[model samples]
Target: MRGLSLKMLKKITNPVLLRSDLLMVVLNRDSHWILVVLDLKAKQICIFDSIKNPAHKDVVFKLVEVLYQESESFQSFAISEWPVIYVELLPRQSSSSDCGVFVMKYMERLLDISDGEWSWRQYLNWQVEMNVFRAQIAYDIIKFGEQFAKEPAKDTKFCNI
Candidate 1:
C-alpha cells in the first residue's frame, strides 16, 4: 500500500505539490471519514474533525509511523518536530452521517481558499451548507465523468490492485 501510494503521488507534475506544502488526506476512522491536513509550511498536522472529538496526538503518531515506513520517497517527512493541532472549532456536522461529505467540503474549501487569500480566522466561520454544496459536487463530478469519458486514462498504473 505504501509503495502504491508513493508511486501514485509520483505522477504529479506540479512542482508545488511535489514539494507538498499541504498534504490533505481523508481518513476513515471506524466508518467515519475525517480530514487530516499536514501543513508542511507551518510544520503542523491539522485535523478537522466534524465531530470535534479527535485523538490528535494518537493520529499524529500513527501518521508519523506510516510516513516513516514510507520514507523512501518522503525523505523529509519527519513528524516529531511538528505539532498536532486538532481544529475542533471549525465547521461541524449536525448529524452522524455527514462526516464524509464534511471532509470533502472541508478539503474543497481549503484548496479553493488557499489559491487566493487564506486566513484561519476567516475560515473558522466558513459554514458547510450541505444542501447546496452536495448538489454542486455531484453535478461537478458528473460533468467531470463526461469529460473523462472522452479521453482514455493514461498508463499510470504501477501495481495491479
Candidate 2:
C-alpha cells in the first residue's frame, strides 16, 4: 500500500491518521448506533451494528472518499478497492434504547484486545445486562472525575462564558 504514486499523496492534511493503525468511528443513523472501523494495517473497513443495515456501508464508503479528497495522506489509498466487511455475528442489543451502550461496549472491547487476538465471535460472549452496563459506565465516569479532581491544577486559566 505504500509508494503507490505521487499524485495520490497530494491532499494529506492530517499526519496523525496516516500513522494510526486503526481508526474507529461511531455513527448514528436514525437514532441507532453503528461502528465503523478502518484498519489500515489490514487494509479493510469493518462495519459493526447491533441491527444489521446494508445502507450504512455506503455511508462509510462515502466518508472514506471524502477523507481521501480532503486529506493528502489518505489520497494514496483507494478505499473503493479495499474490502468492506459487515460483521454480522456480534452480540446485539435486546432493546433499541441500548444501542449507545452497545456501541460504547464494542469500542471498549475492541481496544482491550490485542491486534493479533481479535475475534468477533469471542468478543462479547458474556451476558451483558444493559442496566448493569449502564451503571458500570456511570461508576467509571464518577471514578474518573474523582481522580481528576484530586490532581492539582496545571497552567490554570479561566474564561468567561
Candidate 3:
C-alpha cells in the first residue's frame, strides 16, 4: 500500500499544497476503505476508519513523509510530525462490505459540518441506515449519468450514430 501511495503521488499532475483547508484521501487496504483527512490549517491528520485500527496511524505517517518531500508548501512546517488522530468514536460498520460506503458518508458528513465541529453522535446509527444510503448513492450516480448523456456532442461530424 505504501508503494502504491508513493506511485500515486508521483503521478499527480496537481500538487496538493495549499489547495484547500482540508485534503481528503480514501485509501483501500486489503479490500477495506479508510478515509484520511489532512487538515492543513490545523497541521494534523485525521483517520476515519470503520473498523478503528491503530495500525493505520503508521501508514499515514509514511504517506505524510512522502507528501512533505514532494511539496514545497510543507517545507516550512513539520507536516510529517503532525499529530495522527484515529477517530475511534465515529460510526462503525457491522458488515465488511460497508467500509466503502462508510468512507463516502464520512466525507459527505465532513463537508456538511460547519466550522470544523464534528458530531459523531449523529452518525451512530449509520449501520442500520446503510441500505438507504446505498440506494441514494446509486440513484445519484444514474441521475448524473442521465444528465451528462443529455448534453449535445461537441463534434457531431465525427459520428452520426
Provide the lowest-lDDT 10-residue window in model 2. 1-10
TM-score of each: 0.75, 0.76, 0.80
The 0-to-1 C-alpha lDDT of every candidate, in the order given, reads 0.69, 0.73, 0.80
- Candidate No. with top lDDT: 3
Which order, best to worst by TM-score? 3, 2, 1
lDDT of 1: 0.69
Per-residue lDDT value at 2 in model 1: 55
List runs of model 2 lying over 4 Å from the truth: 1-14, 123-128, 152-161
Superposing all C-alpha atoms, what RMSD in Å does each candidate have to the true structure?
3.8, 7.4, 5.7
Q: Tens-digit lDDT track for model 3 on 53-105? A: 88877767766777778755565556778888998789999887999999999
Between candidates 1 and 3, the one scoring higher on TM-score is 3
lDDT of 1 by residue, 1-161 (tens): 35666655554344554577788877776787878887877778888888887564565567666764555444455565677788855777777788887888788778877454444555554345677777888999999899879985677454443
Q: Which residue pairs clash within candidate 1?
A: none
lDDT-based ranking: 3, 2, 1
**Candidate 3 deviant stretches above 4 angstroms:** 1-16, 151-161
